[model samples]
Target chain A: MPTTDADTTFRFLGCSEIQEILGKQAVDERQLAELLEEVPLDSVYYHTHSYFLRSRFIERTYPNDFAQWVAQQLQDHVLAERLSVVDPFDFQSLEALREELISLIDDHLSGMRTVPRATFGTPFYFNRSRILEVPTGIEVQTLREFRDAISDVDSSAIYFHVFEAHLRLQREENDFSAWFRGSLKLPDLADRMKALNPYLGSLERLRSNMLTMCDEQLAKSGRG
Target chain B: MIRELEQYREVAPKGTIDFLYRLSDLVQDKRFLHISAVRYGGGMVEILRRIVPIMKAMGIEARWEVIAGTQEFTDVTRRITDGLQGREETITNEMYQTYLDVNARNAKVLNLDADLVFVHDPQPAALVDHRKGGKWVWRCHLDAGLPHRPVWSLFRRHVLKYDAAVFSLPGFAQRLPIPKFLLYPSIDPLTEKNRELSRAEITQVLDQFGIARGKPILLQVASFDRFKDQIGTIRAYRMAKKHHHCQLVLAGSGVAHDPEGEAVLAEVQQAAENDPDIHILQLPPEADREINALQRGATIVVQKALKEGFGVSVSEAMWKGKPVIGGTAGGVSTQIVDEATGFIVHSVEGAAFRIRYLLSNPSVMSRMGAMAKEHVRRNFLITRHLSDYFTILKILSSE
Candidate 1:
């Protein structure tokens, strides 16, 4: 294996989420939209992005909590489908994402005669998550080292670099892609890595896809 | 009896134990105090017994203290807890005063000085009034989302004093002014109740209890409480027994603090009515190994509860590679993935139908059982629970 840059090292950061109930409950889409306007930006970030942490499985019907609540509790699959397609990564900030969510609910409500309420005792309680970052002590300088670390690091570490850094922190790119382009100057490799979608599957599948790209890049560079 | 973090390496997810070590390192200097009602019985005590030692091993100063109370005090507190679960218990002004007096007396003797203090359930929640310093958390383990309005009004004042509150599920909490955290209660897979048992050991335990091995054993291991609905379970078993030749084993022991267990047991025994197939064994709380063997020997475990709180026994059975038929109570549905891990039933007839369905299809039973064990391994294990606690403590310590 050859190192492109021995001077710069990418430190793998891991994080665990502790969810806090915001003491706000919404029984109908009207209340949900109102709370979305008033709740903290952290609450907006959590309901949209923390779906991966909750379900470790490969298949998910809805990508975000708001969509899932609407589909299951409100029994409005049409609105859920519209809300599910609103990806957070497209928005530059959570505030923008929050506006999109409120807009979707308000639009859906205007077409309906009666607003649907959730069943008794099953309201969509608003919650916010606190992310606690812990250093994994793994630092890599080469693409091969990064590839090996991805296989060995915790899933939460993968989540931190892929979802949290890219979306929540409003980074220009994910930690892996940014490290690839900046440290190693492999812009092609970095763009290919950025193409790997985080919302398609579980974290394990994401790691595998990232590792495959590294392997392909290494093979072309004669580092295989 | 404490095991090292290294011992759970094969059982836990890769790097999970290491993640806990790193999180614990962040708050190694903080002192954690856990206050509950009793030293014996119940799920909270069982968790503290295992979690405290492991926290100490990780170099955190963790201590557990129980609030000692009189029999009268226990009776009054029981009413309070029952009322919190939406049961129509007659809690007079005198009973409420007794509950506070007991907590006040215990607060004077116990050390309320720690970096983070966890007061378990409503019995010791009022102790937040006497807090000297540090962050106090009211860790409510009940399905308290729809609590009796009067009981919640009396209890909400004490909860408002705490810095934060923790509940087993998001739906299991009330509108508290303080920040509330949702942490799922966990089962220690390394414990005797959940550990792997050999086939010979399982058979011997079954023989001792006169529960024959050939037929599929329909087992429901829960305390004989009305909310647990052992009577409904018996009816379900009887309905299923009409079709399949099976043995129904309802095994449980009374907790010291719960006074209704004996009466519930009597009603359950009467419902069962000397049926040779319905083996009602009221074993003591120390019968962990026997319970483990019974769960392992079971073909399909049933937890048809009308109400529950995280359902540890359901997880324990699932850990032993048994698919469960659970009711849509507090967290039972959360544990059992419908149609994947097990079926969630709404009534006794639904429970019977699922039991019959599982019995008729052998491959689905095995497949669901394997999925159930894997599900528990990934989510309901102690390691995940510990990570949640460390995350809470780290945040509280820094604040």
Candidate 2:
């Protein structure tokens, strides 16, 4: 039987983003690299992760703002391709991701004979977002309820529990995995949930994977 | 009749209505007052009509008011609006005094005691000078990127008093010390102009307009204004028509009274030169169903505006599953994903090239159309607009 503790129940939270301009502008790659070092971590997070929230229709060619600016504005496809491959989930902190971005730009700058810049009007402006978390009004105490809630909640809810809980909360694992292991006493299920990466695809795909994991666990334990 | 928040559950994206309920619960006690120039006949009024009731239904104390102005006040405000949009307009000292006098007169009558007051556009902007107390926000709906320095310098002093400002696009926002937010204007999906139409109804409206069938329809729905560049659109259509057999529909209203609108309409007519394929529709302002039918029946939509203030027609067409070839103005480029949902063109040649390319590839056209509808669903819907406002309100309440 599952524990009846209130803390053990998973409260699904969804987020809405309010983008704010930070007044930091960069006209070139070197300028961008320099600003990247000084911008708040929220700006970095906003550029990399907010794309998933804002655009759910088209797949982005370059995932991050830095890569997209270089590719579209500066026309540096080589640098863009390199920057696109540096996934934010691979780094422990946004600071680490910032360093990796600056280093890559520096290396690309060294190989080039002349510096490249965007047009006068199309400079990259640094922005940050304030994320307001709203409760989904659905709490799940069992794996079956979790699976049902996963299908019912919004994509923002999935993004919150998986991505934001992992990075912003600095949890060792996502909220679902942590809940499953600590409360449900299911280490194997937690491991399965932890291995799934949200950065690989859309939030819909991540929700499907999480549901599949929950279904498998329920079936294996004969509780579904 | 005011719509209940639950009524939007059918049209809104999944969980959005519920999310709004949750967000609204946080600020049910606060008062939100929206003050603008007119109570009717504009996009701002239409939005306020829907959102105020919806916000009230969500349990927020939301109300809307319009500022009263004299003929001189109206003339001065019009010139100020044109000046903000980078148009050449003369604003004398008397006009500035008239604008302030009208605002001061209206501020005395209107209630300025709300916890959050949203003073929209330049007409009622100076009402902040009479702000009793509360967090005031200036909402500019024009393309105010490059304004006349003297006018901006005078008007900008009033804007400085606001706690924050909201604009439709980053490029449209002026450089102010206060925080600025970019919130794209949205189209109500449940409205008569955006509701789903039957095939027979669409055919009836098209046939009623004398627009022929069996040819690819490239439509641009905009007012008869120089900034809309209807002549340029006709030129692009002519260039594309050499290889592909297509018809161009330029449908709009509000050309009867305004002299400039009449001149632009005449210029467009001259460019068309009685071409049978080009359909120039002088629709009445209340022809929402016809516009909806035209958009639905169109194979591709074009909005090649040289300048715009967040083209709502672009979103209207995109909502009907049409691939839009938009220009890099106001929020056209922001709405169209550029080769994904639709194509973003810079010039007449660019618009013509994309129109030809899409006409040649039917599969790409359908794909882009599907993506365009989804993009509008995600970004430009009334639900998302409310969500943004609630987010801002929640943030400000906390502060």
> Considering just chain B, what TM-score does every model have?
0.91, 0.96
Q: List clash counts for every candidate, in order.
A: 0, 0
TM score of chain A per candidate: 0.92, 0.90
lDDT of 1 by residue, B196-234 (tens): 888899899999999988888999998888888989988
User: What CAPRI class is candidate 2?
Assistant: medium
True contacts kept of each: 0.57, 0.62
- Clash pairs, candidate 1, are none
Candidate 1 ranges beyond 4 A from true positions: A1-6, A28-34, A70-82, A102-117, B1-3, B88-101, B234-247, B254-278
Cα RMSDs, all models: 3.6, 2.6
Interface RMSD of each: 2.1, 1.8
State every prediction's TM-score relative to the real structure: 0.90, 0.94
Query: Which 10-residue window of candidate 1 chain B scores lowest in summed lDDT?
Result: B1-10
Model 2 complex DockQ against the native:
0.61
